[model samples]
Target: MPAPHGFEHLVRGDEIVILHHGVRAATLRGAKAADFLARIDTEDPQLLMARLTGNYRRGNERAARRHPRNQS
Candidate 1:
């Protein structure tokens, strides 16, 4: 997928606050926060933030489930 837009992160002491479209999405703490900080510089920041906030799944999951290809 194309790199997501409108995703941002903020570091607050021991916490990393993930935001999507100017709204709070997820909060990473301790190890998670550290890990995110480590990877943020090396990877696609927007995509990483989207995944961290569990916002990567943007398609219609319910429709995909009902598609003929998905039928048992």
Candidate 2:
């Protein structure tokens, strides 16, 4: 699959705000924000953002189970 996009982050003081498609997705504070910043450039930003914002696994289990390769 193509690399994920439309995810960005903003630092506000000690907090980090994650945005998806120009809207607020999640707000990380304290150690969470620190960890995110440390990995932001080292890891896949889009996937990390998605996972952090709880969008990575949003209701996709059923679809995955129904895939042809998953058939019994």
Each model's lDDT: 0.89, 0.90
What would the TM-score be for candidate 1 when compared with the true structure? 0.79
Instruction: Rate residue 32 of model 1 by lDDT.
Output: 92
Error of 2 at 44 (Å): 0.8
Q: Report the Cα lDDT for candidate 2.
A: 0.90
Each prediction's number of clashing residue pairs: 0, 0
